[model samples]
Target: MMEVPRDLFIPPDALEVFLDTFQGPLDLLLYLIRKHNLEVLDIPMAELTRQYMAYVEIMRANQLELAAEYLLMTALLIEIKSRMLLPRPIIRTNEDDLDPRAELMRRLLEYEQMKLAAQRLNDIPQVERDFTLVQVLIEQTVAKRLPEVNVDDLRNAWITLVVRAQVNRHHRVTRAELSVRSHMSRIMRDLRGREFIEFNELFGPSAGVAEVVVTFLALLELVKESLVEISQSQPIGIIYVKSTDFLTSV
Candidate 1:
């Protein structure tokens, strides 16, 4: 077994410390180029490759396994550097030959743009990170509703009242004299000065059915004689009685 030397285990340089934090080889390369203000279009491949290998050596010394992507990028940089060092064939042409660094520059530019966009997205307010979920207690009112009644319900109620009235009614027999002529005279006296009287006002609730019938007959007789007139605007409207003498005066 061979033992490694103590000098070989030296810590990475301060410049290479930032390399560990980079996302990928391109990110580290971009950082190095930008730090030195080197033009990406005209990169000094020799210096860039030296710095890249230094970081890689440090990673390997630290026993940190290098990613396949980073190793692949390192090989590409070495190949480009070698190609640049080789002698070129002289040829005259209208169009200029493509630069070896053009592809790398394009990739670097695209990676930089994507990185900036990622940073911007990360800076935006996140639901769980920047803010916490809030719960609110609210009071609400519940309404009490009453049952609805239809026309049939009202008719049933009326029938119940009629039945209850009949059950509570008292039977009595007495000889009470009532005359249509007397009722007519009394109605005429009431209408002497009045302009109009409602037909219902002529018969009160206290008046029995017999009295109401006689009063109604007396009203009809008065209308027949032209002494009183009953006027109603609509078929179901209230009937109003007016004496002919009172009408003539108006």
Candidate 2:
């Protein structure tokens, strides 16, 4: 029995077919020419142009908007065809010989290079892995013990933060009088529904520099009132403010 060959042609109208498959007019033309096994250097513009126009017609008939650039390239192909038909005096210089297909070939090569480069970049590991302390898991039989350095350091840090937030009751006020209690009330009102606020961004351009100092004091009062939590994961790191309003009732 004789085996029949299957049709290899892909139908132009596939559902949800991404236009990205064809980079541009040049890419589409190249695909058609290659599919038919035609010579690139001597591309029969009349046949190629007809094939290209068929695609354009298919797109328009399907209510797909054809880009202006595709039309411009169609005009270019017609112009090149007309130029080839006209018998013009060829300039013969020993130094250079310019092929009519040179420009198109150059563009194709550049596009191909960029395509490969993009593929290579995509293949690279995107999410970088950083070693974390908790990743050190040991065998079940091994009697492993971990150091308590993080706990000790955290305890010392908590003590320091508490000490820093305490107001110096003995110090007398000079120049201007300010109360942390009033500032705390203002902050609580501002953050009633908001879950978080940047520690430094609460102030505006017109805000006096003293507002920063007052805000810090307000934050301390809020932390003490159990209405908010203040924390920094690392020294000189970004300070975080989380609403503990839910914890207040508990």
lDDT of 2: 0.62
lDDT of each: 0.73, 0.62
The parts of candidate 1 lying over 4 Å away from their true place are: 1-20, 92-96, 142-250
Please give, for residues 200-248, the per-residue lDDT of candidate 1 as tens digits: 6786645665666687778878988989877654444556678888866
Where does candidate 2 stray beyond 4 Å? 1-18, 39-42, 90-97, 128-250
Output the number of the lDDT-best candidate: 1
Query: Worst lDDT window (10 residues) for model 2?
Result: 1-10
Residue 89 miss distance in model 1 (angstroms) = 1.5
